[model samples]
Target chain A: MEIADDSKNSKRVVFVTVGTTLFDALVRAVDTQEVRQELYAKGYTHLLIQIGRGSYIPARSTSDNGSVAVEYFTFSSSIAESLRSASLVISHAGSGSIFETLRLRKPLIVVVNEDLMDNHQEELAEELAERKHLFCAHPRTLHQTIASMNLDSLLPYPAGDAKPVSKLINKFLGFPED
Target chain B: MMRENQWLTSMAESNGIAVIVVTVLTLILVRLLYVLNRCGKSLRPTTVKPLSTLIVLGSGGHTAEMINLLLELQKDRFMPRYYVAAATDNMSLQKARTFESSSSSEKGTPAQYMQIYRSREVGQSYLTSVGTTLIAIAHALWLMIKIRPEVILCNGPGTCIPLCAIAFMFKVLGIRWSSIFYVESIARVKRLSLSGLLLYKLGIADQLYVQWPQLQRKYPRSIYVGCLM
Candidate 1:
């Protein structure tokens, strides 16, 4: 297969990191032909995925220019770098991923794995979405949600004040508050 | 008759030694308490200098919650901070790095990070847990002595137990001046986690805080501080 010059040099990259836990559902959803075509149509030149310990390996798809566009692995030591270069981030609703993405002020779509036992990610995702920081979807709705997502509506991540924590720390340290 | 006489003589000598040992132990205990009291007085809230704090960052959700809590702390007040992680938990270390990098970039001061051995993971066997816990105690002791933090903070995790135990022992021995502050994780809305139960039941923590009012009713001493994270 010959690679297309347009895809080879295209700038838009999507990063999806599912953290260290096995999130096969998210991987399978993202790997469907429909989702891949939608992403390609939207000008996503590259899709870098960190699938964790998930068993389902995404099949490599070659463009007309034979450039392998969608790349995935079990894990990476360079997740931070990937996050920096991404135009959009789709991630599990893990707090580490959420906070890091927010810190970088990236357009984020969080898909919570409801299959997890006693997962509080749903609560966090709902709260963050309500605050307009990011758009969230369950694993079942991830593909549809991403396909229809409007990047323009996302609110930039907000900075947090130290007031609440400061009060707690002061009290713990036995310092009387002014 | 000769055996009876020897037994009486042996008992008398052992009794004398026991009396001497008790007297000496009591005297040492009194002296230790006096010295500790003096040291505690020096740690009054009026100290102008900033404090060195030690915080335990457990894996996964615990790490995220602790980082959130640390973000709210007045960075200027917590000098030379230390964050502890378990040896096998690379994910926690990575999460902690975000805090270190963000703080250093923003304020030019980076926290000291250390990883110690974990007593046991949830599914590990009881026999291995015992062996690893002993090793964890030694590591915890060495780190605690090296840091000698004025305040030690942790949420609930098995790793924190050994470290807190060592800190509590040092307090009893009057060899260190540090206060243990335990904040129950927000996830534990009903009952305390295993670590929390141990620390609270043993009265090891100087301050115990619960994240919800429901838990406060269960543990009388645990102050409900709402949600810190």
Candidate 2:
């Protein structure tokens, strides 16, 4: 399935992508029926989903106009194109996903893996949040955060003056460059 | 009747032998338990720093593990001045350079890496082992004199033996050299042969850091500090 190039339904359509394991958890966490009904009431037409490795999020079809479609996993090229076409991107906080969303300048909501030890992803999300690059929510707050988000305003701008390597080096050296 | 008497005498002798064996075994078990109890007290993770700079001697995996530990240690109160001594032209030195750069940047620790040349071949023969050991000894002595580090931590197999020997000699010269032997992992014990055995027995190191629980019983001065890494 492809996002239309016309940008006519840009505001009406939301693109959600998740890695397989996290997608399942996210699907279980949200009230799929309520979400469908809410989108239907709002007159939204389409929900585009890109499934991760072995994930399959079942479609909830209450209206003929509004439908959720799952796209099969393909190569990075197609995925990058899909991300570029997306109006709002919801994704797991994997480095690749975060990087792609930033590179594409998409409105992104990043959900971190709480199951993992060290909470390294939380650190990454916090760092990005400080830069105003992405919106972050834990699984607990995901539904409300996603619903309340102002997508148009939150669209990522160019990464103005953040140079990650230099920042990392400076942090390590305990001295910032003059 | 004569055969019955002989059988009774034989049974009595066997019973006496069994009693002697049981007594000896009981004494050994008691001694072993006492030793274990003593070691258990000492092996508790107490914060102790080498008196001087911790010179990690070796190259490759052992050095890598040591560097990782050093990085972890830099996060806490005990900040020991450290240097890595490696063979000139060792590939591990290149890896060490990358680690040192990245680690120094991340942790803000001022750790330096250096290479030392061996005056003789380390793996030719017993005589060469001796000669190489002497050259390594001389190199270490010069380094200790220049750096004046109180402790020389040995991570190398052949090179460390000599360095520790030199440290012992320096101890004789009234220089207090606290030597530490870091056994990488339990798996390494199976790989050690005659020389490793000798190094294990000579016990030059003031404290031996072992990763395995089983080794705690073998080395009297060993501190089972979990995994160094």
Candidate 3:
């Protein structure tokens, strides 16, 4: 489906949050001039990126006017607010970020940082994707995935039940079902 | 004769007061033991009035695990769930709303969410942590007295330390209203986190659960329930 009218300026904002950890590579990839032009064409009028503790700052380009205004922040106190306003979210594969984005029922694309110990984030991302809750992309293929994403075909995230955990709690609470 | 009579009367009055005090103390002691016994009875399979459970929600991973646990348990079985988190940790509070929003749609009472002062920020100085810990303890005590939940549940977190301490205190005093349960976070694979270690060493929690098999084997007391999240 067509995301935006070619004649009209798109007002949809895309929020990319890296959580509290550093994700400089994702920031750098999204910050490039080529990526900006493609995102603007895809009906995203504004791009808000939370870089966290990342070292690389997205260079502010003066020539890019009304098409897509790029903005970046080191951290944000009101991520919930940003998530609420955002049309789409691209996040690092942290459980906290993944669950929150899913809870909001927002269309999310999670990119896993392979550098982390234990590779837990990748595990979480794969599980969430398998459940059809979100799409998972590796940092290497992030830009390509984002560029080719067909919003209309995006599947609805299933809000998985906590039956197993609840059962355990009930057993511990001594109210196990007969 | 008059002075001797007065002295005897005064001694009798003092003794009378002592006897009354002793009687009251003995009755209180008996009641305390009974309460403790009843709290212990909760471990056995019996019909309880859908216990009031207070879950300590730590930020990030801790909150996720606890939320997952809450989802599995029957909503009706645990009536009037209470959530406590650090005052600064708004994210946990927001995440907890998933349970509240789902539970609120149902017929009965709504869940209560309370934020206590954080004992310390990450990378904070020891002296600062000490100062804040005192404040957190006072807040915890008030919350414990107010909620008086039948069960106190939490995954490992620094904020839970004060609340668990209060629960342990109540248990010791034979208040026995809240039974503490500590579930170690999923992040801890090799060993217990600082909060888990403290809870285990202090013998504060009545029941402890670990996500990994190794933790259960090493700790002995911790029940290995596998992964929650």
lDDT of each candidate versus the true structure: 0.76, 0.52, 0.75
Off by over 4 Å in 2: A1-178, B1-51, B75-82, B105-109, B118-123, B177-181, B184-186, B191-199, B227-229
Q: Please report, as a value between 0 and 1, the fraction of native contacts recovered by candidate 3.
A: 0.37
- List, residue by residue over B1-229, the lDDT tens digit for candidate 1: 9999999999999999999999989978886666444432324565456788888988776787777777777666777788899998887877777777866656757578899999987457767789999999999989988988877879877899988887766776767767777877765776787799898887777667786677899999777776644
Would you list the clashing residue pairs of candidate 1?
A: A2-A64, A2-A65, A2-A66, A3-A64, A3-A65, A3-A66, A4-A65
lDDT by residue (tens digit), candidate 3, A1-178: 2223333534677899999768887888778766677777777778889999999998655335645777888887899999987877889977678778777877788988876644555755775566566778876777677788766665655454445445555665677575
For model 3, chain A alone compared with the true chain A gives a TM-score of 0.82
Candidate 1 lDDT, tens digit per residue, A57-86? Answer: 988654544232788888888899999888
**CA shift of B146, model 1, Å:** 3.3
- List of clashing residue pairs for candidate 2: A172-B105
Error of 1 at B125 (Å): 5.7
What ordering of candidates by DockQ runs from best to worst? 3, 1, 2
What's the candidate order when arranged by decreasing TM-score? Answer: 1, 3, 2
Of 1 and 3, the candidate ahead on DockQ is 3
Which tens-of-lDDT digit does each residue in B53-135 have in candidate 3? 88899878788888787766666767678989989888898888866786566665658889999887755777778988999
